[model samples]
Target chain A: MVEITIISGKGGTGKTSLTAAFAHLASNHVICDLDVDAPDLHLILKPENEYLEEFFSGHEAIIDQNLCSSCGECLERCKYNAIKETPEGLMVDLLACEGCKVCVHFCPVGAIEFPMRRCGQWYLSKTRFGPLVHAQLFPGEENSGLLVSLLRKQARGMAEKENYNLILSDGAPGIGCPVISSLSGTDLAVAVTEPTPSGSHDLERVVNLCEHFKIPVGVIINKFDINLDQVKKIENFCQDHGLSLVGKLPYDHAFTEAMVQAKTITEYQSGDLAEEIGRIWARIEALAQLKKAA
Target chain B: MIIALASGKGGTGKTTVCASLVRIWDKPVQAVDLDVEEPNLALYLKPELSGRLISEMEIPVSDQEKCTACGACSEICQFKAITVLGEYLLTFPEMCHGCGGCLAVCPEGALSLGARELGEVLWGQAGEIDFLMGRLRVGEAMSPPLMRDVKKRLDSSRDVIIDAPPGTSCPAINAVKDADVIVLVTEPTPFGFYDLKLAREAFTPIGKPMGVVMNRTGFGDAGAYDYCRATGLPILLEIPYDRRVAEKYSQGEVIADALPEFRGRFIELAARIRELAAGDLKEVSNG
Candidate 1:
């Protein structure tokens, strides 16, 4: 099975919208939302969660006053400063906990419990489109990378069982851990961007990241009409780097309108933008199976 | 004075504002571009390096001839970057977070710390600004260390401005954590509003005070305003959608050159940030 990941170096460049539309176009594909930190794909796919799983990550050290020896050892041992002294005894602020188990190893009376931290939840759900894998990290949780890996594994398993041919993932913005995890096994990555200065700038960053992994990459310039000059610069850049300048989509209010209604532009209008996305998805599929698709 | 150009979301003119700030500074301002994971400040600045490029960390390389393929290295890795399956061993240096947990656990004297170039930290000057940027090596998993290296160049007397990477992830956290004050840059859009909330979550954990600068303001999304009201984060400046601004940035012009009025605004931004950094907001919030 081929995997195509849609990533933007910068966020809010409509990466998820494009991914959702491409998912619609790519039949027999298992869709996964790897942006576990602030996943908004659920806002659009509206996946009907079929199965849910609680992801228990390793723990932040919490002190028990009952077994407490106030030697002030735990307070100094915590590198995250998670342990704090209270009027009665010691307390642990769960959010600040790094789960490094520093205090647990050094606790004199074994007062510190290095229990698993309740970070987030992962889900296997059925969307109108197909089998969707998603996850939600609690507001203050820190294990987004783990959640992403779990979701990706679940999606891969589902795709294999269902005899699907593709795993289309929407990666979180930036060159962070989650993005790295999403790109780990991607066959092709389409870097969605705009014609603005930061857009072109951030596009190069994401493109560089894809290049690092030797992942075949394509560039999609969203709202290319906003600035033709910048578009030219970006096109020239893609050509120079041997990256396929797949398509240059124009600025359209239909995107925002679609988002408000939780619909992909491909679903709402089925017009030029949709047609363009269709072509791009086809190219992506071709790029993934470079020899076979050709 | 420290000027931080941070938008809630990516592609919302954070680097545009930083490029503008650097152009107008006209004096020697130490510009530390801390967006290490995908730093683009160098692209806009086009600055030549007057500094050395050095790798940030030394990864532990296993000498296959020296020892057995014991499972000790795999067991101690908090990152799980190393694993041994049967007679085969898999090592993903990209997954290594540089904790040295594996090296400490290795037996048979098999592991030796070898220089694996993960990324580079360099210092360069752009216009009147002494610029520093951290470029994470391709396939390198860790970025925080490179960002910290760039941040180590800060001179208290220099007018410092940081171009932070987008999102509230580890790289963003590493970029903005040590800033005296964080100036969140956002657009007046629903998407920007949503991600700005994510950025807010990142900032509150550090207990650092932050303000906002609204870019491309003509769009009728008042989510940024609503967010400001709810969180008490003041809106410092708003740059409306201007075609000239786009042209200047496209041609690698400083944002301040296209809109000269922003010089005072940024200078004032510096002052306001210092005031906020003087424990003003912390006192107010905790009071």
Candidate 2:
């Protein structure tokens, strides 16, 4: 199966909107939202969870105040400042805690218990289009990269079991851990970006990252009509880098309106938006087929 | 007085606002470019900081001559950056958090520390403002280390304005964690509403008081404005979508330079932020 990940140089460049549209156009695919840190695809797809799974990300330190542990020994050992004394007790911020367990290990009174913090929940759900895989990380809790990996693993397994031909994954912005995890073992990557100075600059950054992995990449310039000169610059960028510029969608309120209605652009109006997305998918399939033949 | 320019979502005028804010301020201000990875602040400021390079980060590297086939390094790592396979000590440097746990536990002392070039922290001056920018070495996995190093140079006496990275992730955390006040710059769109929730989640834990700056004011219902109203967070500024701003940004000119009127506007922004941050920061230390 071919895996296609849609990633933008930065966020809020209509990456999710494009992912939603592709989810609607690609009927024979399992959709996975890999932007687990701050997932937004679920806002449009509205999945009806068919199966729920409790996944253990990592361990978190908890202070057992009943053991009479006001010795302040744990505070000195912690380098992350994760452990703190509160009026209620010694409180640990789950987000700040990297699960190092230094406080727990150093607790002289044996008052610390280290256990798995269920930072987020992963789900296998059904949407209007097809089977979907997604997850949500608790607010302010870290380990989003782990959550993204779990959802992608489940989606790949589901695709194999159901004989699905493709997996469309939406990746987070930037070249961070989550973005790296999403790019691993992918067949192709579709880098979505705008025609602004920052957009072009950041687009080159993500492209260079994909280059390091030697992953095949494609580009889509959203709202290309906004800046005609920047459009030329982006096209030139793609040309110099040998990445295909697949589709250029005009600046339209329909994309935003579809989002407010919690519907994909393809679902809202299947005429122009869907046609453009359909063309992109056809190119992806053809490229994948060519690779398979080679 | 310290003000931080941050965006819940990426690529929404954080750097642009910081450059503009520093350009118009009358007093000497210090600009801290806290976006470690892919820091584009220098691209805008064009300051001379060639000689200021510091590589003070060091993590554990194994000396195989004295190494044993034990799994101590892999066992103690909290970031899961290290994995052991008998005699093979596989290390993924990007995931390494540099906690120095494994080094302390290695009985053979074969696990000596080695320095890796994670990124560079540059220091210079722009006009009257002392400028500091961080550029994460292209492939460096660890950003918080260099971010902390940048935080060390913050001139608390001056009006310190930080140009934070985008998104509400670890990089963003390193950018705005210690700021006396945070100004979340966002556009008016569904995507803005989506990541705004994440941005709010990021700061509430650190307990930093925040306000919102709605860029491109009339693009939509200004969902961010609605969020600000609901949460009782004040809207700091409403910068309309004007061609002049876009043209100036495209030409690599700061907003205050493009429109002289905006210089006074940013100066006012700094003043308002000073009042808010000055009051809240005192509470932060005591609380």
Candidate 3:
């Protein structure tokens, strides 16, 4: 199976919207939203969750007051400064705790309890397009990379079991842990970007990351009309880097309008934007060596 | 006071707002870009970087000669950064959270600290504003550590404006955690409104006061406004959607410099942020 991931180093540059559009255009593909921290693909795909699973990764140090001797040993040994001497008693600040478990390991009286943190939830859902694998990381939680890998694995398993030939994934913003997890091992990494300086700047970083992983990249300039000069610069950069310049989408309110209506651009209306997206998907399929939808 | 500009969704103009506010603020504010991964604040601030330092995280280095392969070090690691397979010991520094647990649990004292290049921290001056930012090494998974390294340069004596990364996860939280107040910049769209709520949910537990700056207004839905009203999150400022502003922003021009008319708005935003931060401090002291 060929796996294609849509990513943008900068967020909100039409990654989710374009991924949803590609999902609508692709045939026999399992959709996966690897932006577990703040997933938006579901807003358009309208997935009805078919299976749910709790995700537990890493460990959080919980202090048991009953077993505590108030020796301050755990406090002194904690590197994260998560152990706070509060007015009530010694408390563990959940936000500051990095789940290192140093306090649990070093506790003299065994007052610190190390339990697996329920980071978030993953789901296998049914969308109009196909079966979607997505997940959500609880607010203020870490280990997003692990959760992203889990979702990607589930998508691959589903594709194999269901005989789907394509796995289309929407990756998280930023070239961070979660983005790395989403980008690795993908057949094609389609970077969706805008014409803004920030867009091009971040796109370069994402492209560098793709090159580091030796993954083939295709560039799509979303909102290309916002800055024609910047678009020329981006095009030149792609040419200089020998990266595939797949498509350019104009600045259209239809994207947001369609999102407001809980629909993809293709589902909302078959205008220039939808047609452009279709062409882009065809180019991506060709680049990934996947058979085009009949 | 430290004010953080963040949004759950990216490209909602956090860097634009941050750079504009720093330009118009009436003091020598310290501008920190905590978005180590793909930091773009420097593109707008145009800081003349005077100093650069490599930021490194400590990972366990094993002494094979002294190693017992007792699996004690690997057993204590939460990230599985270290593992013992048969008689060989392996270490994956990329996966290490730099918790130092393995070093502590090593029974034979075979594991020692080793540095892995996380990124670089650069500091300089942007006009009167003190500028600092972190650039994470490409392919590096860890960012919070690098972000912390940048924030270590925060001068509490001066007003600080931190441009936080997008998303309501650990990286974003680490940026805004120590701030006196957070300014959430977002557009007025369904995605924006939805992620705004998630950002609030993520940051609310930080116990710091938060406000919203509605950018690209006049288009999309009113869901963001309604969310703020319902959550009692005060709207600090609203920047209407303008092609001219966007064009200038695309060219790496600060909004306040590109359009002088918006200077008054940024000035107002700075004043409001100060008031909000000061008010929170007063409440804390009073309580």
Candidate 4:
């Protein structure tokens, strides 16, 4: 099976919109949104839930005030500064705790309890386009990378069970944990970027990350018409780096309008934009086939 | 006062608004780019580097000579970063959370702490604004530690504007924490509204005053505005979707710099933020 993940190093670069469009274009595929924190593909795809599972990862330290002598050992040993000296008493900020269990181990009076943290939830759902696996990491929760890995594994299992040939994933922004989890083991990492300095800078960073994992990467400069000069610069960079310039999409309002209507670009309007996305999909398919043959 | 600009979604003009605010502030403002993964504020402000510091996180290293095959270290590690493989103990530095838990639990005094270079913080100046940005190492996964390092340079004596990372996660929280005012930048679209709601929920617990800056005002629907009004988030600024703004932003020029007329607008925006932060307006009932 071919698994292609769409990613942007910078946020709000149209990763979800493109994924939704790809979901509408591709067949025999399972869609996955690996952006566990603040996932937006579900906003567009409107997946109906088949099942929901709570995701528990890592641990958080709870200070038992009654059982406690305020020895301050946990505070001194915590690398995260999670244990804070509050006016009421010693408190642990769950968000700041890395669940390292140092506080639990170092507590002098056994006042600290390290319990599994219910970070978020993952969902198996059915969209009009295909089966989808998505997740939501609780606000201020870490371990998004683990959650992304779980969703990808579930997507792979479902695809294998149903004999699907493709897995299309919408990745989170940044070159961090969730992005790494999404990019690793993918057949092709499609780096969607724009024609801006930060766009090019971040794209290069993310593509380099993909290269670190020896993943073949292709670039699609969204809104290339925004700045023709930057487009040329990006094109040269892609050529020099041996990356494929998959497609150049113009700055079209239809993408946002489609998002407003909760529809894909292809489903909302059939014009140059849709045709352009189709062409991009064709290129990705060709590359995936080439990789499979090799 | 420290004014933080953030967005639930990416590319919503947090950097754009921040760069403009620094330009029009007319005072020595400290512009902090806390979006360590993609520090873009320097691109617009054109800051000249004055100094740099390598931001590092501590990871545990096991000394094999002093090590016994006892699994106490591995057992206490909640991250499972260490595994006792029969005669050898394997420590995955990448998976380590930098908590030094294994070191604390090692009875044989075998484990020692080592530094892993996560990223760097660049401090410089663009005009009157003291520009500070945190750039994470390309392959590093964690960012909150680096974010704290960047925030440590906050010069509270001057006005501070922090450009926060996108999304409503821990890193974003680290950037937005302890700010006097948070200005959430968002476009007028469903994706924008959905993520903005998540961003609001994320920061609401901080109990800091917040407002919205509606970017790309003419694009998409008015759902973001409805959210702002229904949720009692004051609209601090509304930047109309202008081709010139996009062109200038693409060229790495702040809106106030490229178009002199927008300086007044940004200046007004900074004033409004101060007013909200000072509790003078008190129009919006904040969380």
Top-DockQ candidate index: 4
The 10 consecutive residues of candidate 1 chain A with the worst lDDT sum are A95-104
The Cα local distance difference test for each model comes to 0.75, 0.77, 0.89, 0.88
lDDT (tens digit, per residue) of candidate 4 on B18-87: 8898888867789999999989889889999999999988888889999988999888887778989999
Reproduced native contacts, each prediction? 0.23, 0.26, 0.80, 0.87
lDDT of 1 by residue, A57-104 (tens): 876677888999889977875544568788989998775566655567
Q: How big is the positional error of residue A261 in model 2, measured in Å on the Cα after superposition? A: 3.2
Q: In candidate 4, how many Å is residue A225 off?
A: 1.0
iRMS values for every prediction: 3.5, 2.6, 1.2, 1.1
Q: Report residue B34 deviation for candidate 4 (angstroms).
A: 0.7
Residues B253-275, candidate 3, lDDT per residue (tens digit)? Answer: 99998999998989988877887
Identify the superior model by DockQ, candidate 2 or candidate 3.
3
Q: Find the 10 residues in a row with the least total lDDT in model 2 chain B.
A: B278-287
Q: Write the per-residue lDDT of candidate 4 for residues A1-294, one digit (tens) a residue.
A: 999999989876787889899999999999999887779888888999999999999788899999778888888998888888998799998878887888887787888888889988899999999999998888888789889899999999999999999999998789998899888889998989999989999999998999899998889999888899999999999999899999999888898888888999999999888999999999998998898889
Off by over 4 Å in 2: A66-77, A83-93, A226-229, A267-278, B54-56, B68-74, B79-95, B260-268, B278-287
Candidate 1's docking class is acceptable
Per-candidate DockQ values are 0.25, 0.36, 0.73, 0.82
Q: Please report the TM-score between candidate 3 and the true structure.
A: 0.96
* Candidate maximizing TM-score: 4
Model 1 lDDT vs. the true structure?
0.75
**Residue A245 in model 1: lDDT:** 83
